[model samples]
Target: MTGARTPCINPRCRRTFKADGGSDEVVCGKCFRTLAEAVRSEHRRYWREIRKWDRRILRTADNLKVTRMAAIRDRLSWQLALHWDAEIKPRLIAPDKPESLDAFLEEVGL
Candidate 1:
């Protein structure tokens, strides 16, 4: 209440708050914390799902005989690729390389 006021950049939370006049922050502290947590949660969820597929692939590979290994690996690879492209890629800010949570939140306009 004592400094320059600015509205949170997050569309869902546009509450105005006092900010340092020279600060570059667009989102308020509350919205930034929430968005950061959400990004972390989503990142954990994505990796958990991917790990499930990885475990399945490992198990399938272990159980398959040498003669059928190639086909199984190909099928598993395709399944993972399909899941990523369909379910995960669209939600991510950058799928190619890992990015900081802040970057991810900013990229998604949160």
Candidate 2:
């Protein structure tokens, strides 16, 4: 099939190979260098956007005179953790899909 190849694991490497559907220990030379990178990319994207939202969250949380930044951070962190576990993790399996950070923020009502 046209879409069956996986990208190389090495950040500097540009390679793609067919998925052999074999054991985890089995990896092509290039993918061995960059395994699970898409997952990392997703987390980075989420956190970057969350930092932007956190500025607003803090301002809104502050205007009401909330004294617990730690609590608010913790709660938002948990919400993001759940969002990643539930929504983002599921789609990582199909990395080629049309997923976007804005869509995730919208999904989480951020």
- In order of appearance, the predictions have TM-scores of 0.28, 0.30
Compared with the true structure, model 1 gives a TM-score of 0.28
Q: Residue by residue across 1-110, what tens digits does model 2's lDDT show?
A: 67566654333445566666752222244433343666557656667765866676666745554445445656667776886565453443334424799878877999
Give lDDT tens digits, candidate 1, residues 1-101. 46767765555565786666754435455643543465546545655665665556566645455336555546655665565455443433233435889
In candidate 2 the C-alpha lDDT for residue 108 amounts to 90
Query: Least accurate stretch of 10 residues (summed lDDT) in model 2?
Result: 23-32
The regions of model 1 sitting more than 4 angstroms off are 1-64, 94-110
Error of 2 at 9 (Å): 11
lDDT (0 to 1) per candidate: 0.55, 0.55
- Cα-based lDDT at residue 22, candidate 2: 53
10 residues in a row with least lDDT, candidate 1:
88-97
